[model samples]
Target: MATQTLALTRLAASAWGCSVRRAKELYTKVIRSVLAYGASAWHKVADTKKGPALSLTTVQNSCLRTVTGAYKATPQCYLETEAAVPPLDLYLSARAASFEIPTETTGKLQLLRGACIKAAEIINRERSARRRRQRRPQGATSETPVTLWPSDAQLASAKQWLGGQTVEKALKEKWEQRWFHAVTPTRGRRELAAESPPDCGACHRYDDMLKHEASVLMQACTGRIGLRSFLFTCRVPDVPTPLCNCGEGRETAEHLILYCKDFKESREHLATQLAPNSLRTRRDLAALTTKKDTARLIVKWLLRTGRLPLYKRAMEVGGPPEHVNLFRP
Candidate 1:
């Protein structure tokens, strides 16, 4: 079932046809619903044992990757955060717990409800303990674990004990911490992540962009573009150093967009469109890309610079008709 669903998901999220936001909607509404159809019956085993959840998780990760157009090696956590999708296990547990059974419900149905409640409690307890250990100081004596679940009275009213919003918040926090302490290899992404919102500002605005333009913008934002800095990190044989042809700094997405000397004329034109405030720093760039109008300007600026050669044809084909006159006096 998951195998068949994955094929449909891939087609829906294919680079040429779908926007990131639409892909995510399709996953949540169609793919996820199908995969977790009978989750209430088996969610306990799926949560307690790693094997049962692996297939579901694999499908989700593939779908998320397609949605974001991120590289194969991008971390799963990054994909989840960017796509604003919860972890598969957390989602399954929540889905199981949300089943509403009547007071007169008996036999297997009633037993299933009890089982789901217990599974949610157990899963919450384990997650709490694991988080406590992660937060513990190195070589520090372990303290008594606190009860993470709500009181019995509270639990009665908490249909979604593992609520989607709560899970999403925790996931964002975890992803932020990872981004903050990330090593040099992810410098570009780390910097962008710091300035952007937890759910990724650009992703939410993809609906306003052409498919090709959105794809290029996402790649540029995530530091997976054809830039010399990225190529050097990937150890592409031809890119000996991460320097720009302008001989000023590493040829990164940020550099190309904000500071490349060769793009001076184009930058001036871009600045005119941006108005009032000039694009001088990452914050400026982040703020610009989050809005539909300014993000289109960013894409146009990128196309004008001609830095991302791999996307040139696609951008030109889907670009505005007057894009050729973007920098003309």
Candidate 2:
């Protein structure tokens, strides 16, 4: 379990240490599949019991802590909310409910939804329980979770435990974070895995650099690099002041790469490539999604400014960044 969740250290190691948001996304993409295969069977079983000797909650909490880049003592609620992790029972019921009406965009998910519903109905219901005279979706399908459990009852237990917050609302939130940002239709499930998938923001891009100078530079464009404050959060030893050597203020990643005075000369040539908003503020920085050209500009500024070496060294110590050094950045 530790190995699976802690594995993010590799991804975090780039001069761009992973941010809390990015860590959460990676946790879902990587660790989630590892921890929850065939999860439905036990997802609801022991999730609600307080501190069971070995509960799914423990595993989830552990993973949540790792992804949020939070410490052992951080509040579980904060971690869960930051990571957009639904409460345990809520997650399971959502899984069960998804089968009740599958999200249609992803072919694979649709199949899984169909299987879970059909399998559960086949296994739980008596052969005679299938009344051909009753209404069914596909001519003569088995009773669905909605039919077996009332629409209101399905969420009753969840609401009771969650201080009246409906599973519908929680699942709706999960749909955006855990699933893609989908707009649920008034009458039916909205599309996910968009026909034109929104490109990843740099903060969420993940690519392990293997070799080649351009690729390394491109990998640097991945929003994996962190700054002084982030490294300090990771408890990196020998950290200098968060303030930049340039003396402007705290050395944030955006300032270091895009807006610092010390890098002004270096950034001069590259400045031509920047989107007007790219060099503006932190939100602009976070919004700098997947334009390979923008990464080139950032890396160019880093190299020209001579901060690249110090930045990479700090990152290596903190997360042990994993770019293949084909060319000298």
Candidate 3:
């Protein structure tokens, strides 16, 4: 049943379909609810056992991948952070723990009551410890705090016991750690905001932007687009090398946007559009993509380059009517 709902959501969550925000909403309201049906009754068992939890997690990972348009190799922690979705175990346990039963109820309700009480106790303990740490004086503890579950701990149970916000914080920390140490060329160059949710601010700011444009921007930012460099890393059979057609360097997002001679004209147009804010280096390009107006221009510039075949329609059709003079500074 969860698989069927996931199949339907794949279309709306696809690269050219809808914004990441909307895609995540669809997953949470539709597919996740379906997967967690009767969770209060079975969550306890699922938490301790791997079989059911693993199956549900597989479905969720697929949904998140589609929603984010991320590569298959992207870690599950990264996908969860990017989608702003809590881990499945944590989600299910929270749902179960929040279930309320009548005080006068008896019989079969006893098992559910016990499970909820146990989950609540675990959550309270963790929450209290977190508060204590936060209350500590600055620099009081030089030791690095542990944000992840212990290696020997049961996966689902440990996560299920944590509060939603706690789980999310830990996941974000884990993502930052992995991102910092990532060996992949493109991923290593990418940066994540410390305090912000992983959703693109640019996409949210430009409410009227086309879905395809948002999708392209996201792919470019994450380094998972159809660039030859990324394709080569994925071992795509047809991509002979990571080199751009111009032969100067690999066809990475950074290379194409900042240095590739092939897009020199488009880059010049981008500079003209973003007057007073030139793209002289990779840091300049990164700064440009963070702002709402400049990010839109970046999208336009990318579309004009005609390099991203997946977004060809956006280039031909152009942006919304109001954005016709988007290039005018």
Candidate 4:
């Protein structure tokens, strides 16, 4: 059900001017809220139970990984607690408890109260049966007496007890984890070279980025856009032999920005804006993304060349990838 919301959030990201926080906010309001709707009713059911929780959790983890842009191997425990998402069982039970049974209808409150009592009765019976089946240790301490049903007070204060409150500190810790993930060291220059490029540019507040920015940077930095070489490599039909339109050489990113005559005018201006000859080599052009002025210069060139927006249009027209987001007001 929430599968599409993940795509929706990516669209929302660009709509909200490529803001990651806005993307997360949209996730909370639209996607997460939908998943949590009517949660209390089935929270304690088999699907939410221990050891065999259903795809509810799996789907949630996927969205959160989308939100934080964490690597796939990030632990599920981290995805939940750190991602500011509640456990399904706990959330459902608490949410169910939080609401007062609608009493406007005749006997509805009584029916609701009766349902709670029945649920509590079932829980107590199961626990008792399970406890009886277990072997006690030689010197285990005496257990507390179990209550079969919740008190009136427990029902009234379900929201508080279940603790749906947002913890700002926990969120900070979560962002901290994301930050750490972004800056985690790699094996050195060769490994860096083999990959397209890292977001070695100035860090975004979020580890990854909102949908639009992430998609653009992912390809631009990684050197995997639909340029001539990429088309030729894919054997795209009617593709010319991977040559630059400028007729000087093949149309690689470095060649276009560094040597192609087409962008030489803008390139010269950008070069003047940057330090002396810093962008001479392909490696330099890629690595210069880490420098503030140099990065700005590159952005100007890409903007002038229509590369960024072209890629952005591709991403939008091509349909958002699995983990993209679009922000909303």
Best lDDT among the predictions, by candidate number: 1
The per-prediction CA RMSD against the true structure, in angstroms, equals 13.1, 13.8, 15.3, 12.5
Question: Once superposed on the true structure, which residue ranges of model 3 sit more than 4 Å away at CA?
Answer: 2-15, 44-51, 96-187, 190-207, 275-278, 317-329
lDDT on C-alpha atoms for all candidate structures: 0.64, 0.46, 0.62, 0.51
The candidate, 2 or 4, that scores higher on lDDT is 4
Q: Write the candidate numbers in order of decreasing TM-score.
A: 1, 3, 2, 4
User: How far out, in Å, is residue 323 in model 4?
Assistant: 28
lDDT of 3 by residue, 203-227 (tens): 3533445666665655666667788
lDDT (10s digit) by residue, model 2, range 24-121: 56677666666555544344322233332236667787766555444454444434443456655446555544433323224554565567677767
Least accurate stretch of 10 residues (summed lDDT) in model 2?
Answer: 187-196
Count of residue pairs whose backbone atoms collide, per candidate: 0, 8, 0, 12
**Where does model 2 exceed 4 Å of error?**
1-31, 45-91, 99-226, 231-237, 275-278, 290-292, 303-329
Which residue pairs show collisions in model 3?
none
Q: Provide the lowest-lDDT 10-residue window in model 4.
A: 189-198
Candidate 2, after superposition: displacement of residue 4 in Å? 5.2
- What lDDT does model 3 reach? 0.62
Query: Can you give the lDDT of residue 175 in candidate 2?
Result: 36
| Model 2: how far residue 230 lies from native, Å | 3.8
